[model samples]
Target chain A: LAKTTQPISMDSYEGQEVNITCSHNNIATNDYITWYQQFPSQGPRFIIQGYKTKVTNEVASLFIPADRKSSTLSLPRVSLSDTAVYYCLVGVPSNDYKLSFGAGTTVTVRA
Target chain B: SAVISQKPSRDICQRGTSLTIQCQVDSQVTMMFWYRQQPGQSLTLIATANQGSEATYESGFVIDKFPISRPNLTFSTLTVSNMSPEDSSIYLCSVEDGARGTQYFGPGTRLLVL
Candidate 1:
């Protein structure tokens, strides 16, 4: 498992774009970057995942550079409801059965 | 994504007592996971529940403290034994989406030990 470091907290305003970055300096070739969003009192939800370059979905986008040492999660036009803890995880496909979550970055979306 | 659910969504237990949390997935899964989230803390993997075998627990967690059972593919249970104030947290169950390697979580069981 690759240890990840991310901002402890971030504040963003409604309608503004929010980007959160995670660094996994020792990331392995087989590891993939996956991001999850967790609301208070609920389990974390899958947001987006990527191995390299950029991947976008209905909810968010993930950008991974060639180095794969870091990745960014971009949320478009954020809303107050988007406030939650976002976790960045790096692991291999075979280890999909196990996941380690860090403290995560707590995004506070204010009006 | 998998639709997961848990039993006894919330509970208040006395010290030294035990509580059992059940997790059910809409479809069969080869692997299931149990996680704990303490107040103001991130989710921590407690163990991996595999069907027909003893669950593999993570460091700092043990079978006696957090007993797990995966009798079938879609259902599993985690019993929090000898509860204490520190054990008060949200317990979540998850299953992997084999195709994408993503995990879907249940609503979670909130346990408050008094």
Candidate 2:
């Protein structure tokens, strides 16, 4: 499993964009970068995932550099309800692979 | 995404007692996992519940401490034995959606040991 490092916390205002970056210097070639959002007392929800380049979804966008050593999760037009802990995991997506979660970045969306 | 449910959403248990948390998925899944989240801390993988065989536990976790059972594809249970105040945390279960290439988690079971 690859170790990941990210911000401890971030503050963003409503209607502003929030971007959280994660660095996995030892990321493997078979590993994929995935992001999950977790609300208070709730399970983590899948936000976006990408192997390389940029992948956009309705909820968020994932940008991966060619080196694949780092990835960014961009949340556009944030709202107060978007405040949550976001986790970035790097691993192979398979039934046998267990996800290792790091100290996630807590994004506080203020009004 | 799979609809996952856990039993006894929250419980307060006495020290030395044991609690079993049940996890059920709407559809069959090949993999199920148990995780523990302490207050103000990140989630930790407890074990991987394998059907028909013994579970594979992670480092710092043992089968005697955090026993897991996966009788079938859609259901699994995790037993916390010899509980203490240090064991108080939220226990969550997750299933892998191979088709979606992601995992979905259940509403965690909150346990408070007194």
Candidate 3:
């Protein structure tokens, strides 16, 4: 499993964009960059995933450089409801591949 | 995305007792996992529930403490035995969405050991 490093916390106001970067220096060639958003008392929700370059979805966008050492999750026009812990995970999507989560970046969206 | 659900959404159990959490998925999945999340802490992988074989546990977790059962592809159960206050946390189960290359998790079973 590739170890990921991300910020512990980030603060953002409504209507502003929030970007969270994650570093996975040991990422493998088969690994994919995935981000999950977890709200209080709920399971983590899949936000975006990408193997390289950029991938955009309705909720967020993922940008992975060519090196794949790091990636960023960009949330455009955030709102208070977006306040939650975001986890970045890098691994293959195999059946035996275990998903390990680190201390996620807690994004607090304020008014 | 698979719809996952867990039984006993929240429970208060006495120390030394055991509680079994059930996880159900809307569709058949090849891989099912159990995880523990301590209060204000990150998620920890407990084990991988294999359909026909014994579950594979992580380094810090054991079958004696966290017994797992995957009778079929869409359902599994986890039993927390001889619980302690330190075991008070949220237990969750997830199913792998191989097509999407991600996992969908259940609402999680909140356990409070007293």
lDDT per model, in order?
A: 0.94, 0.93, 0.94
TM-score of chain A of 1: 0.98
Q: Write candidate 1's Cα lDDT for B1-114 as tens digits.
A: 789999999999999999999999999999999999988998899999989989999999999999999999999999999999999999999998787787999999999999
How does residue A46 of candidate 3 score in lDDT? 85
Candidate 3 lDDT over A24-63, as tens digits, reads 9999999988999999999988888899999999999999
Task: Assess candidate 3 and give its TM-score to the true structure.
Answer: 0.97
Q: What value does the lDDT take at residue A71 in candidate 2?
A: 96
Model 3 chain A: weakest 10-residue lDDT segment is A91-100
Q: What is every candidate's C-alpha DockQ against the true complex, given to 2 decimals? A: 0.75, 0.73, 0.74
For residues B63-101, write the lDDT of model 2, one tens digit per residue: 899888899999999999999999999999998878656
Ranking by DockQ: 1, 3, 2
Residues A23-72, model 1: lDDT tens digits: 99999989999999999878999898899999999999999999999999
Native contact fraction, candidates in order: 0.64, 0.74, 0.76
Model 2: DockQ score? 0.73
Cα error, residue B25 of model 1, in Å, equals 0.8
**Clashing residue pairs, candidate 2?**
none
Candidate number that wins on DockQ, 2 or 3: 3
Give TM-score values for chain A, per-prediction: 0.98, 0.98, 0.97
Model 2 chain A weakest lDDT span, ten residues long: A91-100
